[model samples]
Target: MFPLFLWTALLGSAALEGPESRLLCTSPDLSISYSFCGGISHMLSLGVKSCLTKDNTKDDLYLFFVPKRDIIELSVAIQVWFKAVQVAKFTEPLCRGFDDEYSFCGVLKGETINITVPFSYRKFIFPQGQYTVLFEGISGRSNDLIFCVNATVILK
Candidate 1:
């Protein structure tokens, strides 16, 4: 019958393909682990989850948070491989809502916001290794600690 013929074709093609023909690939189930660095855990939650992308070459970070206080300016320190480095420090303005790149910029205090940040590793040929990143934030005006997130990423 035609039904049996169609089924054979479908199964035959699927078995022929390899991992490179991945239709849907995802990382292992992961949880947001606690870090020794300080953070406003009362209102922020961070996690790493595999998200589908066009190229299927990168992973993303998911953040759901509510700000406890008004934030105008932000300072960030990103440490790779769990080591401190001066070059990884930077400062940027918060709440640039007009820019489409930051759709969650206009969030108000007590309002919940969820956003995804992607890590694309295809452009640069990264060496095979286990990499971990630590992101620490401080309030620009008060110079007080706000949040710290540490995550490990594996690249193949």
Candidate 2:
């Protein structure tokens, strides 16, 4: 559960828009739900079935989803991989401070978790290549995996 103060701060922002496309994961952990928003219009979607459409607008990407209701003790992690090479890793603490134009202020709405990735963020810059984003919800007590999302994105 998030503190009341944090929740209030997050909800102060405008509600997130939807995504233009959905990137499907190979075998998503069903305990959690995910959403993605991007482009200038901030189109939103429940999930990405494949690669996102090519866009050079350098718009920010928003990730929002709900976690399991029963799990109050867990930490989240975001990882970026390019051609199987890990390029970036974000822990919960790091994400909390990554609120510049390059990232979102980690926010919680009800059971939903929200995060943003600004185009100016170094990790979002692809060298005219493809990449994968992994979002994980991990158990805090036993250090076990709770939920995971693997989405592919291409930069052109």
Instruction: State every prediction's TM-score relative to the real structure.
Output: 0.55, 0.41
Report lDDT (Cα) of residue 10, candidate 1: 40
Which pairs clash inside model 1? none
What is the C-alpha local distance difference test score of each model?
0.52, 0.45
Per residue, candidate 1 scores C-alpha lDDT tens digits across 1-156 of 976875675444334322222112234422223332453555776555654333565778677878765455455666554122222335555543245246555455687878888876567554444455556666666876666655444544
> Which stretches of model 2 miss by more than 4 angstroms?
1-66, 93-124
> Where is the poorest 10-residue window by lDDT in model 2?
25-34
Model 1 scores worst on lDDT over the 10 consecutive residues at 16-25
